[model samples]
Target chain A: MHSRTSFSVLIFILLIWEILVNLLHIPKFILPAPSLIIYTCFSQAPLLLENTLVTAVEILLGLMISLAISIPLAIVMFSFPSVDAAITPFLVISQAIPIFALAPLLVVWFGYGLLSKIIMATIVIFFPLTVSLHSGFKQVDPDYEVLFDLLDASFWKKMRFLYWPAALPSFFAGLKMAVAVATIGAVLGEWVGAQKGLGYLMIQMNARLRTDMLFAALVWLSAMGMGMWLLVGKLEKHFLFWLNDTKN
Target chain B: MLRVCDISKIYSDLAVFTNISFMVEKGSFAAFLGPSGCGKSTLFRVIAGIESSDSGHIEWEGLKLLNLKENTAMMLQKDLLLPWFDILDNVLIPIKTLKRDTKTGESEAKRLLSRFGLSGFEHYLPYQISGGMRQRAALVRTLLFDREIFLLDEPLSALDALTRQSLQKEILRIQLEFDKTVLMITHDIMEALMLADKIFLLSHLPMRIIKEIDLSNLPKPRYHLDFELAEMAENIFFTLKGELINA
Candidate 1:
């Protein structure tokens, strides 16, 4: 019921937008109708697909890099207080610093290639993953700690059996968050400096005043982000199957 | 024997309990009963070594238990089962924690689950089971921990009257059949009277064990009835009622 409402609301908004643009004779460059944007999507399919692939690569690579670093970092942060204390300030500074400013620096150091884009997305993705997972680890019931402490468990064994599974729901929450923001990082990187990507294509089209094509790029970019988010949701439902089972 | 000696806990200059001490003989069920917020739970935590007392020592089988001791299996009112884990896996938590072989623990967990009337629900989550069943699963987990002593913090108080009665029987079986020493903390005078070989009635804050009722002289399986049971229950009730009035 809720999803149906949302779908119809979206359709309603697009219809109003198309009609207003056409009825008012708005310039296509100034404000392309949704119909024109949809037309541009099919006409420039190959071009959009190529740049979509580039941005998609950046987002996926960034996501993988973030996951690789964050999961272990989260585990260590939970295991060792000293590590948590030492690493927290740097983590805060990383998030506090704007990605836009870092993008130029990233471009300068890693060049206007996929490396810089991937790194850009990693910077955007890392904090949420680590913080969410760390918070999840912290949220485990103290009763379970007594159980572990009584068993004379080593930190690794506890993390493997207890903390890891306990923290997964929140870790997936972080991953979904990362997937949503990852496009921003990838696109922003391309906007700052990139040889190829949807952001680069959008920038090029904007300069040429191809507003319909620009909107088409946006449609695809958003679709990619939405697709990734949905994928993460699917993965979460699959892996954290017990959460749903518990709700029943 | 599990012995707590000169145990005390003070918070911000207020005494939660002072010099509280008790002993439970091996294979005996001892209930530490007191009113709410009388620091009964704190004393239990001290014994379990989950919380450090202001000054105390707990000796289990002649070894001082400074931190968490492997000799005791503790359960709380909440089952504390990992909700994400199925019944069988939740029961194997101690096995997983001790880094023991799962292949062996799995079969043992199955046997125990079947014994506890959770035979077909091995794959069910905690929320899927009834509250009584969840607690029973937790009991199975505690048993699988396979410690010589069980530290229970109102482990069955959350259930309905019917379920609580049955679990009381289960606790008795654990002590009598398994021969594990049990030190349980509860507020219900009757619950203590029924299962505990000794019931230690506690005072209000700055709590002390004001009275220790020895039920060991009574016959096995007290059944929550009998003239002596009512008499002792009434005795402990008035004692706590007097304390409540005093407070």
Candidate 2:
């Protein structure tokens, strides 16, 4: 029902955009009609897909790298208060800075390669993942800890059985946020200095007065982001199946 | 036999138990009855070795229970069924957590759960079951620990009246059949009367065992409607009310 409403609203907006472009005599360089953008997307499918795949790789790799670093870091921070105390203020300070501002520096350090874009994506996705995971680990009810103690469950056993499961729903919540912003680092890095990706294509298309293709690039970028977000949601549903029945 | 000697706990400046003590004989049912939030749960926690007392010792038989976890199976008021686990897994958690052999866990769990009408729901999550059923599953999980003593912290207090009554019978049967020493905490007056061989009335803040009523020789299959039981419950209620009123 919600998707139907969104689809109808999109169609209505596209129809209005198409009509207004025609009536106002809007040139292609200024604002291409939605239909023209769609046409450009179809005509330039191979070029668009190639760039999209590059960006897609950067995004996935970025997500994987961030997951690797942030999850363990979150675990460490959760397990040791001294570590958490040392790192948490720094984490907060880092988040306070505008992450995009570091794109030029990242490109300079990692070069104009996939590494730069992947790092940028990782940066964009790291804080929320770490903070949410840490908080989830802390969410172990004191009572449940008592239960584990009564069972004489080892620290590793508690982590594997209790803490990990308790942390998952919140971790997935962080994952959703991470996936949503996972594209930011890749696209920004491409804009700063990259050989390939939809971000570079958009920049190039913008320079050559290819506004239609620019819009097409945007369509693909948003589609990638949405795809990732939906995939994370599906994974959460698969893993945290008990969440639905938990309210009882 | 379980002996709690000079057990006292205080949180900061607040006194929870000054020097509380009680005893439960082997193969007997004991209930600690008090008003809600009267530190009975805290006392159980201390007994289970999940928490420590400011001053005390708990002895099992003739030996000091340095590690209370090895001897006691506990069920909490909330069921504590680990919502993420299936009914069967929840039942087997103690064995797994204690690193016991799981080879025979499935059969034992199935048998216990079947006894509680939870057989078909083995794979179902706790949230999918009724509250009473989940509590029963929790009881089954506690039993699977294969311990001689059961420490139940108001295990049936969250259920409906009928469910509470039914579970009371189940607990009593389990105690008799397994020959387990069961120490339960409840605020319900008649419930203590119905189930326990001895009921200890408690008063908090330097918590004291205000009264200990021994019903070991009381007729079996005691019911709420019994004239003798009602009088006893009334007397206990007044004693609790008097404690509350005095404060």
Candidate 3:
């Protein structure tokens, strides 16, 4: 019921946008009409779909690699404060450096392949995942630890039962932010230098003033970002049912 | 029997407790009745080997219990129920840690919860339940470990009067039924009188055991009691009051 209202509001805005673009007689180069963009999206669907798939693969792989690295990094930092103290400042500095600024350097060093783009997305993903998960591990109620200790719990048992369950909510929080940034990172890396991606296509169309295709590519990127975000939200709801007030 | 001898703990420059010596007999219910902030919880921690005393020796059945946590199951004052886990998962924590058969362990947890009047609450998280229910779940978790001794650190302090009285009776019954030795810490004199087979009354810091009373002769359902038990409760209250006055 709530979603239907939002969907109607979106359609209403799009109809107004289409009417205004047609009535004002805006040129196709500066701002294409919604109809022109939709036509371009469908007519050139095969080419656009290929680029979208490439970008999606990069973002998804980058996110998977980030998870592989950051969860363990967060665990190590939580387990040993001295390691956290040694490494945390550098991690903060890495996030402080803008990804756009790093994109050219990454392309140059990693040689403009899928590897460079994946690295860029990973760079964007690693910080939030580590920081949020580290906070989760550190912020547990002291009472919980005392209970585990009283049980004579082994280290692995404590990690599996206590730390894992306790940190899941925060890990999901980090995952939401990380997945959102992943698309941007993939596009930015492609913008620097890539042979085939939506970012590469956008650069090509903008240079030649094929503004309809450029807008179509932007639309696809936005759709991809929203799709990933919605996926994470769904996962949160399914796994964190215990937090809800309802019986189910 | 568990013996704690010459236990003294000094925090920083100040002494929290000194020369705290006591013994809890096997299968006996012992209560440490003390004033608030008299380091009763700290003493229990020391005995459980969660913390170390500056000078002390704790032994169970003649063997030194340097790491007593291996054998002692503690129910903290706060229920300390893991917020993420359901009551069944929370109660099965000890079984999971000990690497027991989780299938049978889960069945045992269900039985205990049903016995504790928490039959429909197996899937509920700690926050979904009332304070009394959470306390009952915590007790079930502690009991599942099947430890030789139980350390109850003011377990009923958070409940209302009626709930406290009910739980007091229930715990006394559990002690007798399971033949368990329980060392309970509380500031309620009447509670000590009703449930404890023996009570050790400690004064405020630097805390020491000032009085010990035997309540084994008292009958069951001692909450509202005969004249002799009532007089004994009054005397214990005055003893604690005199310590406050001196302090």
Candidate 4:
């Protein structure tokens, strides 16, 4: 019900586009009307679905791999200041290099398969997750550490109990931020070289001057991004449920 | 019994405190009364073995406290209750960390909550409760560890005046019931007078004990407007005022 207003606004814009295309006699190849895009979306649904599945799988795999790697890396950095000092500069340099520029190199290294795209997405997501979580570990209330010390809490116990629970909000923030960019990274990989994916489909259709099909591919990509974001939001609500509403 | 002997802490090149010495007999209540930023909390940390002092010794029952971290529990100015945890889980932190039996810990936590008038609030998160309740939960957490010495660094200063009064009585009761040594730090002279059997008045930075007052003769269930206690409070106030001026 809340989304109805946004839907209405979208419909209003579509009506304007449909009216302008017919009134101005705009060529369909250059700028298809919303009606043509919607028609193409339905007519080529099966082909779009297949490409969307491939892209969706790549994004999910990338996010999973990023989580698996970044959490442990963050914990290691948190545990060892010398290691953090050594690794932080490399992390910053790697992050500075644009993911788009690295995509072709990744494809060359990992082959023109789903692995390359997964690595691309993982690279885009890794920094935010690791840095946010590491800072969270470092920024715990000093009083809490003092309390833990008074209890003679072991390092492992401190990590499992105090550090992990304290870092949940930051972890969720990183996850949400990662979701926003994960799809773009996956598409960039496909753009460089991929046998299947919405990015590859978009490129093929654009080369053929099939603008309607290109828009359809874009629609599916955006839908996948939206799906990921909603899923993360749900997980945040369920797992970090103790966070106060005022904080949000 | 706990003995803190000539402990000094220097951060970088600056000394925070020097030649700080005190003792709390077993089951005794002591207060380290000092101005803000006088390193009272740092002294507590040193005693708790969280931070090491530049030079000095702290011993409990003839054994050095440096290796006896498990025998001390600290209650800081802020309750510092884990906001994510409910009251029960908050109090069970030590037990879980020590790898004790959860079933026994849960029952003990339940008994403590009810004993402290915190019954029926076991499931409430820290943010869901009042400031006083949060402090009570922190006390429950500190008490659950079965430690012999407690380092309370201005534990009740953040509460409202009335809550402060009641919690002071609760603290007195806790000391008696647990038969534990308590070294509390506070700037409020009345609070120090009301709760402490002995008071160590500390001067400003590079803190040293300006005067040590013995109040063992003060009447129990100390009234708010007692003349004898008020006289001592006034005397300490002027002495502290003099110290402030000299510093």
Clashing pairs in 3: none
Residue B214 lDDT in candidate 4:
84
Worst 10 residues of 1 chain A by lDDT: A239-248
What's the CA error at residue B101 for candidate 4, in Å?
A: 2.3
Q: TM-score of predicted model 4?
A: 0.96
What DockQ results do all the predictions give, each relative to the true complex? 0.70, 0.71, 0.59, 0.72
Clashing pairs in 1: none
Model 4 misplaced regions, further than 4 Å: A1-9, A244-248, B64-68
lDDT of 2 at A203: 95
Going through the candidates in order, what fraction of the true interface contacts does each contain? 0.76, 0.69, 0.66, 0.79
Q: For candidate 3, lDDT tens digit of each residue in B1-247?
A: 8888888989999899987788888889999988889899888888777888899788888998654777788988899888778899999999988889999999999999999999999998888899999999998998998888899999999999989987887788779888889999987878887888899989989999898888777766675556877898899989999999998
Q: Where does model 4 sit among the CAPRI classes?
A: medium
Clashes counted in candidate 3 amount to: 0
RMSD to the true structure for each prediction, in A, is 1.9, 1.5, 2.8, 1.8
- After superposing candidate 2 on the true structure, give the runs of residues whose Cα lies further than 4 Å from its correct spot: A245-248
Stretches > 4 Å off in candidate 3: A1-26, A34-39, A245-248, B101-111, B118-130, B225-247
On TM-score, the candidate that comes out on top is 2
Judge the docking of candidate 1 as incorrect, acceptable, medium or high.
Answer: medium
Model 2 chain B TM at 0.96
lDDT string, candidate 1, B1-247, tens digits: 7788888888888999887778879899899888899988877777767777888778877888664365778899999888778888889988887767999999999998898899999998888889999999999999998888888999998999999999999889878988999989888888888888898988888899889888888777776658888888898999999988888
Residue B223 shift from truth in candidate 4, angstroms: 0.9
DockQ-wise, the better of 1 and 3 is 1
